[model samples]
Target: MSFDKFKPKYKIHSETENYFKLRAEAGAKPYDQLTVEEAREGNIANAKRFAGTTEFEGTVKEFTVPSKQCSDGIPITVYRSKQCDLCVAPSVFVYFHGGGNVVGCRQTVDTICRIFSRDAPCVVVNVEYRLAPEHKWPANHEDAICVVRWVKMNKGLLGAVNRSTVGVGGDGEGSRMAALVCHEVPDLGYQVTCIFHASAA
Candidate 1:
């Protein structure tokens, strides 16, 4: 029986295909089967192996936002591109990285945040929210809300004091948190999501 008749409607990206092939060759276990530590390590390894380097021209700094959920606080990295005007402050974005709220960290999306700051030309506030199998539900969500609220209130931290000066966003699961935040927080200037299908309503 010829199976050519059964064709896939969506084409797989070459890089994605290569990833699966490589994983299979290495006998990698499915994500669900792996221990939390293994999954987190794999995420870091994949990011380093596949994510291309960017020529970022910017100033980078780190700070912590006082979380409403806990005393530990949320850590954040601030990226300000060289192109940003010294006199006129740019809008700031509270960024989150995707890892199903289970894995991934600030470094996982560090370079991507640089690209956003350089290309999108905004101050990128990369967030480090709590992970699961540890902090549990409402912890990560509350952390995101706390950070955005903190940014909204402490606009001077990023020098984004002007109108429409604060926004929130992320990729994948992180993007999901951003969308949820938009629903809860009022007057969020903008939302930048990468490869996330948020509801139009």
Candidate 2:
């Protein structure tokens, strides 16, 4: 049977519905809500908050940008592809995964990245930054910066990603990173053409 046909609908708890109603009355719009700017901030916050809540547990592949020396470490667990194309498509999207600056992994965001790669017909880089509590504030941020820099430095390794047309997005804590990266576009010598922050805590 088709999965959609066999899909089951579980009833939501009354309390849950009530809570949602309360929020709706309080000027909360879950779908198609808020202006572009407002949504951007809210989503970024959610990505940052839910950093340690979700994950991807399964077989995974690894990609490395090996350093020339022992000090130049470079190997990232890739959850998506970065094949270069020869066409003049659009820009690339460098994504950051959310894990509250604590948990979560690149595998957690793999599926989404694949979809994005196909849909946007552009390059997508899912940054694997260091977690927090063990690293702290600038730790993850620094990792993010480095990853973006690496992508730019090695765009050829990335799938035909147009360096001029780049975007950054994230979930919860990742969303926070996305926003920060977006703002630092000029400073990073990268013009983050677009920014999307979703359900960011």
Q: Considering every candidate listed, which one attains the maximal TM-score? A: 1
In the range 10-38, model 1's lDDT, one tens digit per residue, is 56567755665665665556677888898
Question: RMSD of model 2, in Å?
Answer: 12.4
Model 2 alpha-carbon drift over 4 Å, by segment: 1-62, 65-87, 161-164, 187-201
- The lDDT, on a scale of 0 to 1, for candidate 1 is 0.79
The CA lDDT of each predicted structure is 0.79, 0.54
**83-152 in candidate 2: lDDT tens per residue?**
2233464456777776566555665666676656655545667676766555567867766666666666
Backbone clash tally (model 2): 20
RMSD of each: 4.8, 12.4
Shift of residue 100 alpha carbon in model 1, Å: 0.8
| Stretches > 4 Å off in candidate 1 | 1-7, 196-201
